[model samples]
Target chain A: MKKKKKRLSLMRKRMFAGYLFILPWLVGFLVFYIRSIFQTVQFSFSEMSMDAINGGYTLTPIGWENFRYAFLEHGSFKQTLTSSVMNMLVDVPLITFFSLFMAMILNKKFPGRAIVRAIFFLPVILASGAVVDAIAMGEMMMQGGVSGQMQEMEASASSAIAFDIDYLISMFMNLGLPAKLLDYITSAVGRINDIISMSGVQIVLFIAALQSIPSSLYEVAKIEGATGYETFWKITFPMVMPHIITNVVYTIVDSFEQSEILKLADTTTFDMWNYGLGSVFSLVSTIVTCIILVVVVGFIQKRTFYYN
Target chain B: MSMKKGRIKKAFQDPYQRMLLGNDIKKFALTILQIAIIVGVCYVILSPVIGMVVNSISGDKDAYNPMVFIFPQYPTLERYKLVMLRMDYWPTITKNVLYVLTLTLIQVLVCSMVGYGFARFEFPFKKLLFGLVVVMIVIPTYTIKLPLYVTFRNFDPLSIITAIKGGPINLMGTPWPMYIMSLLGCGVRSGLYIYIFNQFFRGLPKEIEEAAFVDGAGMWYTYFNIMLKNASPAVITVTVFSLVWQFNDSFFSNLFLVSPDIVISKKISTLASVIANEDKILNVTLQELYLHAGIILVLLPIILIYLLLQRYFIEGVERSGIVG
Candidate 1:
């Protein structure tokens, strides 16, 4: 009877120990992350006071005007959003194809594959904060007439492309139905840069997944007199489908830099010092994020999750 | 059948049979195509970085030409030296970085250790606790920033041994805020490392622990002595990831530290802040030097760590299935 009582107490002690292990994260989430979201949502519907005179914390509650401004009034917000998304559309497919294509090439026996891999991987290093900025600075210097070689080329190139999106839009309008449709498609693509840049991480994930497929599967296919194309579609492609779905979801989660909605929220918080407004904007973005997860991930999971 | 025999004969009769086994002619063609395509890929993707590296080392960088060839006629390390000094060499650079990293390690350690306990042990709300861990990932940084700000602002909770650190310390400007945040296993991303730990720890073989149990070892003893040591690869992966990530984030660094002025304007001096404020970068011929210095300072740790633990750290992140 005493031994049985001791065992019961031991179980209780072990349970407490388990809680202690996870305590730091639990404290962190409660204090900061989870609470912040809740606070933002609470603050959203209220009108915020920004009176510099009184230095009061917040004021009366406001309504849906903030959302209205973000969605409708701000042309710059719209432009930045379109540009980001457009860049993503072109970027995601192009990056994925290139990285995978390059990985396949590197995986093969080659004299200079290592050198090539090193060169390709250099961008990841360079893209970090300071290096990228320096690089940008150098480009600015080059364009500002420091370079003897590039001076004429920069001039000629700028003249040729003239990169005016509005002008291109005008040209599309002239092209009639087909061009207009193309323009619509491209602009629609341009709204989500988050998807594009995040594709880099996904590309790496896919490459890893591709390499994991047993060469034995391909060997078997080849034994049956199968061609490389058939092996790719049947064996290599299907095996890596799970990875593709995971990477896509991962990309959406990362969202890298702040989105337009988040940016608007930042302006409210930091720029205007309207914590209430900022919080509301954030709540809305978080909701948007959940909706995105539901649409993209939910669908993908239903289709391909059986492989898991 | 005769048809199959005819097909085999036709296959044997083909003149271009060398293509199948990488015959020199076909291999040569493929190699050439691969090289060309690879070059294009390199050019499009790496131009900015390549351009920067080339331009920085170039003797004629005063011309600031982005299209210079790979080799500089007059190579310079002058920028390298200058950039290093400006980025705060000692405690601020190394100290802040190291402090945050140590915090991350402890955070991950506690998290995974706890995670291991929860995964393998039976406790109240075992399922409920695991559910919370999953929920932790989806929570955004913006949500907790204010409450965190308040928590860190609370002097008593954080300031028990104020004299211990020789200042009336609040958690805000120092590494404490970052430390406390990472302690919970949430870095820049949504609980990536902690999630990784849970995912990885759950996969560890249970037989080892069972043996420990038979030997009458406590769960803690089995975990630390047996399972923890056995889980070396994952531990390495999580450590390297948390180290690299916590080190890289400028956002929280920007958020946490208010300059002595303790205003938003002053706090805006984090590396990201400085980069964005272009007007502040003194545009003397010194800009090149400053630019070079900044890149070196930012990249040196990464490059140095990459070289020193090149085998372990890089492979760890890659194997952990995270981006390197």
Candidate 2:
């Protein structure tokens, strides 16, 4: 129809406008992304040296030596990479579940709800590299008790609570779980604070998803005489399914990107001037991360129910 | 006999009352559990912060004293004084704050435009372009830092600037790299912000925009006057996130800024290292105290910002489900 043609022209106009709007970012993407990715790959395979002839460095192709060094020569590089990937495998799910659970709890009507929400979000504010490092340092001081003085400080400070963690550990030891499993559990326990801190953004994301769910859905379930538990399963759970995937993806990328081991790679490249080796580490890590993301997304996409 | 008869009468009088009594006990038990969890978690979160504060104020003698647990009897600002003298805290903080604020502002404007583009229109390669945006979000900045560093160091993309300048211009140890990245929507997490905005703009009703179109407003006008006015929540979210992230971003800042007065996160790290290495006169415990003081100094601005904007920050986050 003539009307349909007219609408098509309008769509074309809108598309042009859209392109115009995204022009700056497009320019940036062209300049930065494609070029950098190419150069990164190039740098990974070459010996980079300062060129006095020109201002910038020159790359002489060295083949797969950088990659080989990263894999074969650097002992800790492979170890850290594997361990970090393993950590992400555990951390991503744990963070997603923890955030979702906490979000559900915090979404309920409670006294001091605002304060509780703020408390949960306090981590996002304190998520600075400095603060994280500082907290880690503080923990080290506590655990190591750097001096006799620090030991006194700890004893006086913690004397009131007396949780008797040793007793709990001993009891768990007696339960006959394998030693490796017990070690994992203990380390996980130690990492609970880190998990809690990292989950702040995910928790907020889940909370927002929870809030946007139509109250009418809950009312409909209630009218059918659904209990609180049934409503959660039948309504809340399905509605928030997509956000779960988002949180999982976000958490996975975050863990991999910010892992302590990746930081070591950064220092190696930039600080130690091991550009070739560092690029290999960076490239491999990026590939591993992409693989994990694709796998996770594919799995989650099957379960994600898009209503609209 | 009278007591037994009374009990039987009371039980017979109201089954509803008996149910209410049972409910009260359940509620009480639930409340106890809630309180315990909340208190425990809060303590775990706050303990390090408290430690920093306590150590910052505590005298050297207090660290040795078994009796001084929370506060020092002779609280002193000596550690803070040492940190201030050594770190040049004020100049560094001022520069860091200015840089973060300006960068945040630029990112908010640039990214929202990019977001609006993705959200509002159908274009060729739209899917592919947006996919690239998603890739930008996924790939860590460290991976590309080398190339980015070279790109900025040369100060030319496609050699146009080099052609103009007759040679490459080195821009290391300067703010141009950050400025250029932010202006072009390639700053830290710029892609994420664009995605957030794109999602938000898509969620907005189309009828209002159509009305603006009918009123003869152009796309830019509709976006600036109509869409932006209604997109305050998204703006707030982006701004807060950009601010916090930029404030916390030590890695990139450290890589770029070779100047004396750099961002707080970088400054704190360097100061901690310097103190750890340089303080021979101070005991191990006192050196630790000074480091803690330095940490507190760096955290003060961010903590203040959070306190001031807590309400908007909460609303911004609560409304960020559009991204989800």
Number of backbone collisions per candidate, in order? Answer: 23, 0
**Candidates 1 onward: DockQ, in order:** 0.27, 0.37
Q: TM-scores for chain B, in order?
A: 0.69, 0.81
Top TM-score model: 2
Q: Which residue pairs come into collision in candidate 2?
A: none
Candidate 1 chain A, run of 10 with poorest lDDT: A188-197
Per-residue CA lDDT of model 1 for B41-67, tens digit only, reads 665455544545654565545445445
Candidate 1 lDDT tens digits, A111-179: 655455545444445444434443555556533423444555446544544454456666777777587
Model 2 agreement with the true structure over B151-201: per-residue lDDT tens digits: 877786678876898888888898778888899999878987887677557
Where is model 1 more than 4 Å wrong at Cα? A1-23, A51-56, A63-119, A128-143, A147-199, A207-242, A256-258, A303-308, B1-33, B59-74, B85-143, B155-169, B195-241, B258-285, B307-324
Grade the docking of candidate 1: acceptable
